[model samples]
Target: MDFYLLLWLCPLYIVGTIVYRLFLHPLSGFPGPKLAAVTHLYEFYFNLVQDGMFIWEVERMHAQYGPVVRITPHELHIKDAHFYDEIYAPASRKREKYSGFVAHFGTPSSMVTTIQHEHHRLRRAPLNSFFSKRSVVQLEPVIRENIGKLADRLAAEIQKDEGVIRLDAAFTALTMDVITHYSYGKSYRYLDEPDFKLAWKDAVLAASANGAMLRHFPAMLAVSKSMPHWLLKKLDPQAAVLLEIQHMVRSQSVESLQRLQAKKEDNEKTNTAKTTNNDANDNNDDEQAKSIFDALNNPSMLPPEERTLDRLQDEGQILLAAGSETTAKTLAVISLHLLRSPAVLARLREELISVMPTPISTASWVELEALPYLTAIINEGLRLSYGVTTRLPRVAPTEDLQYKEWIIPRGTPVSETSYFVQMDPTIFPNPDSFDPDRWIQAAARGERLDRFIVSFTKGSRQCLGINLAYAELYLTVAHIFRRFELELFETDVDDVRLVRDRFFGAPRDGSKGVRAIVRGETLL
Candidate 1:
């Protein structure tokens, strides 16, 4: 009798909540699926069980219900193109990242995951200079060297494997090595691996997966963060990898700290006057290991709370992964499109030859970036790949958002994704094609197509790795195309199709990477 009574009461409670949400909720008038309005499970099934289908579903919802849709009981998604600038404006104090949106990395402490605008600014201030245009130009030799190493590895692979090499693995190795070396002043050198089998890349993806998992089941973050690795491996081995990385970063931080302290102590011992140390240290940068560790640990203006070993470790892991993975993904996009369309590839190669004209013995990164056709190819790649496949939610905590007719109340979550804007048929005709000419033509006609490509997003909270990613993409693409003549080896469009939006937009399965043969000799 008691069980029967409980069952009746549970139905009554669910129906009551649904009815209230339908009519009385603040967002009740907004158009969306009835199931979504009632509960979050509608989104959970799509995002989790379906592997990030929620973003796609939002597009579908917009198609059915117009531009604005109630994505969740508490969040609203806007699909209007005209409203993008207003939403992502440089002056908008509404730059607070949605807590629910960022819970994935389980890194609320990270600058990428920080929710408060002022706090995010404070956290991001120290990282800005490291990725500046001047900084990237200064580091061009390091980037070019990494790209050259990959070419050497690729040439060796081509020789061994009948000129068939897996470009996905090769590009991943190059990016992982470059970012790690740039950030920590040393790299694991995944490019040096026989066949470039980077086990650490698997760890990086697993960490991203863990972050996505944290978004839906947030309590799992606490458990995942605190659980012992030995025990974790028994149930879920992938998650244990993330823990190992954290531990590894912690050890590195301690070592770096000790090294810096020893240097300071040695300086003090050698001289009675401390005034000469700063001048001497500036003149002799022999012990200067320029890395994220050095930059972050030694910031004089950052708050004390943001300057812990754990904070540094969390940030280092985030920077290394974010910097490497996204750039690699974009390069893969370029490789896929270029392979599919031989004409576009031919035009690009011709342009490259016209500029260098001497088999590309040596080319400046800045000069390579300035070439008209090369810039066009890079732009098209960025647009086609769409940096992140999903939208990043921004909440205006203190003020209402106005979009033409509708006045969205304060604290409402709003978002726009590159996949939607970059692929908009009205803006980009034949949106699916890999046409470098689109960018070139648009430039000639004076179209503001540049604004449409939100690969790095817009406004203040934009990617900190923008300059670095550009430098890598520009150098790597120029280096590869100039040095090697590649043909698709057992590779097709389906292999590199948009299968999942996890971590970032990923290619379809059964794709053994961007496999190709090298038919030309190294020119740079």
Candidate 2:
């Protein structure tokens, strides 16, 4: 009788607690579903069970319950185009990343996962110049080289078989090669792979499942960072390839550290022999161009904590993955749209021909960028891609967020999605259609459509690889279109459709990728 009474009491107690949370919590006043107010598991269901559908569900919540709706027991999601800038504030503001997101980024050491505003600033400072516009422009030749290799391969294949190249595979290979070479002073040559059989891309995609699990349960992230390699492989075999890549990154970082240490010892021995301390530092382009490895290893610039071997490994992984994946997807999407829309392709090629009237290889990025129609096409591509297609949560630990009359308290997670913001019809008109002319027309009207496009997000936490991504897109688009006339083959809208969110959006119905045949002669 006593055991049965306790069981009945437990059920009653749970219900009572939930009733209190739904009706009497600090955020109870906020407009949202009663179930959402009761617990965060509502979010967990959509994100974990439904496979990253929570962002869309949040949008639906916004439709039903205004802009500011309680998404979790402790968090509020605001999907307002007008307030995106305010929500994702400047780096100067106290915008700490929500703890819920730390898992997706892999490690707390990476600046992307750093929570504190000042901490992120200190961590990100060392990497600023390496990814700057000047740095990327200087690195364009290297970019063109890998892209040139891809173009050559495609051209040769077309001549041999008149085959349809998978744009996603081609783009992924091109991007992976460029970024690996850029960051580690070597290329994985994913392009060099026959049919691009690099399993690393699939491995990266699978990690999205790990990310969702980690986000829902933070305990996994801690274990992931500290757990032994043998054990992780035992649990999930796919992690072996992922871990192999990370180990490769760690080896590069360790090599840089060793080189730095050897130089220091040599400097000391010289000073002792000569009885004089000559502190000489050389910042030549050769040393400067050694890739992001040496830059992050600089002791004077980066703090000791941020420069740990483990931290360096995490940083390199994030940089390589972040730098490559999004760019590859965007380029694939752009190529797909261009192939599908012949009129758009015709107009773009005419502009390219008018500007250079020569081969694509001979034309510099500066020349390609100068073409108004080309620039408009790239902008439209960025707008449509929505590269990181999920809600990025930012919490103001010291300040309350004001969404109209509602005062969301400090430490409450406030979030927005790139999907809905870029898809907002009020701002984009026909947001679904891939129309480059909208941008060209907007430019003619002097409208700032660029402000509304937040694929890279905004303010302090913006993507560091923006310049590099831009360089890749500009160069690849120019080279491919200038060299070959691409057209869709056995591929349709469903192949590239944004079906499920895996952090990076996945295509519907298991389409291999955007497949198209390569035609025409190399423009050069």
Candidate 3:
């Protein structure tokens, strides 16, 4: 009798839920596929089964249903660029992150994954100064040192048969080393690897590939996360790379904490000795060893709960993953287009030459930033790379959002993808063309095209590593292009196309990404 009743109740409950969602739900009036309104499996089919095609489905929804469409039962996606500010709002506005979207990350304690408005703010407060422009400018030596290593590698490659190289992998190696060095005061030294540690890049991509599936089935992610190392390796070799990365970061965090503790004890002893000796010269002026962990461990900077080893590990994971891949993709994009367009390449090379008089000449971040043509090319690359390549949903817990005449109720999840904004035909005419001149033309006409470039996103939760990314872009591009003459090798526009959205933009699966040959070294 119990079994029979349970079977009957399950169907009835499911049917009743779908019916209520279609006709009686708060978002029922909003236009979208009835199937999407009824269940998230509609999203699952596209993102997981169709391989990250949900973003395209959303675009089609906006095309057919209008700019504002309910993408999920509880979430609305607004395609209009004008409405972007209201959704991603400034620090003054109280915008919470949607937990449904954030839960997939498996990093609940990290600043990026924090769901509440106030809690995210608390987590992010101490990190601002570290990623600031001033800090990045100070860290320019680190950026150049890595870029110089890359240049040396490229220079050496010129001696090979075709001097063929995978710019995508090489760029990833460069960025990975810089970020790891920044995080732990020691780099993974990916740039030193012969194959540029392709497995590590695969691991990053694999983690992103799992995100869409995890979003739909968070319980599976939770279970997988808790599984022992041996089981995880058996289950999925690529996914296991994520665990290895986590363990490495956690170990670094523990070491940093221990070092901080030892430093405190040493300082206390020094003070005691000074008091006993009554020595005026004993005013110790020891500078602390610096790493992101050291800053995070400071008790005065963050509260006790926020400074824990667990919190530090979670933060480290987000920092390293966030800091690496996206910037590398942008560099790869810029390199592809530059190699394809001789005029654009010539113009940029001329500009770089003016600033850097010789092939091995060095320039400051400020100096590189001032080159107008170079800046324009970077802006174009960012527009195309589309940063996260997914619709980042934000929730307003306290106030209703106004989109045209529609009233989006408080606590409703709303999103505007950077893809739509970056490639809007009205804003960027010939949006598919890799034309840096669009930026230059906009500037001459006194139009501020920068507002449409949301690759770094906008408002309170914008990318924390923007300054570091810019520094890397400016330094890497200026150094590489100025020093080496690279040509496209078995690569074309399709090699850098935004084919799939694996959290970040991706080219087709089997595609060899953005390969180029070192023609020769350039001299002034």
- Superposed by TM-score, candidate 2 places the C-alpha of residue 466 at a distance from the truth, in angstroms, of 0.6
Instruction: List TM-score per model, in order.
Output: 0.91, 0.91, 0.95
lDDT of each: 0.77, 0.80, 0.86
- Return the candidate ranking by TM-score, descending: 3, 1, 2
Model 1, range 387-484, lDDT digits (tens) per residue?
77767878878888887677788877888877888888888899888788888898899886888888888887788898888888888887787767
RMSD of 3: 2.1
Compared with the true structure, what per-residue lDDT tens digits does model 3 show for residues 34-56? 98999998988899889899999
RMSD (Cα, Å) of model 2: 3.2
Q: How good is model 1 by TM-score?
A: 0.91
Q: Which portions of model 1 miss their true places by more than 4 Å? A: 1-16, 161-163, 270-289, 522-524
Best by lDDT: 3
- By lDDT rank, best first, the candidates go 3, 2, 1
After superposing candidate 2 on the true structure, give the runs of residues whose Cα lies further than 4 Å from its correct spot.
Answer: 1-17, 222-244, 259-289, 522-524
Instruction: Kindly report which residue stretches of model 3 are placed more than 4 angstroms away from their true locations once superposed.
Output: 228-230, 276-289
lDDT of 1 at 87: 71
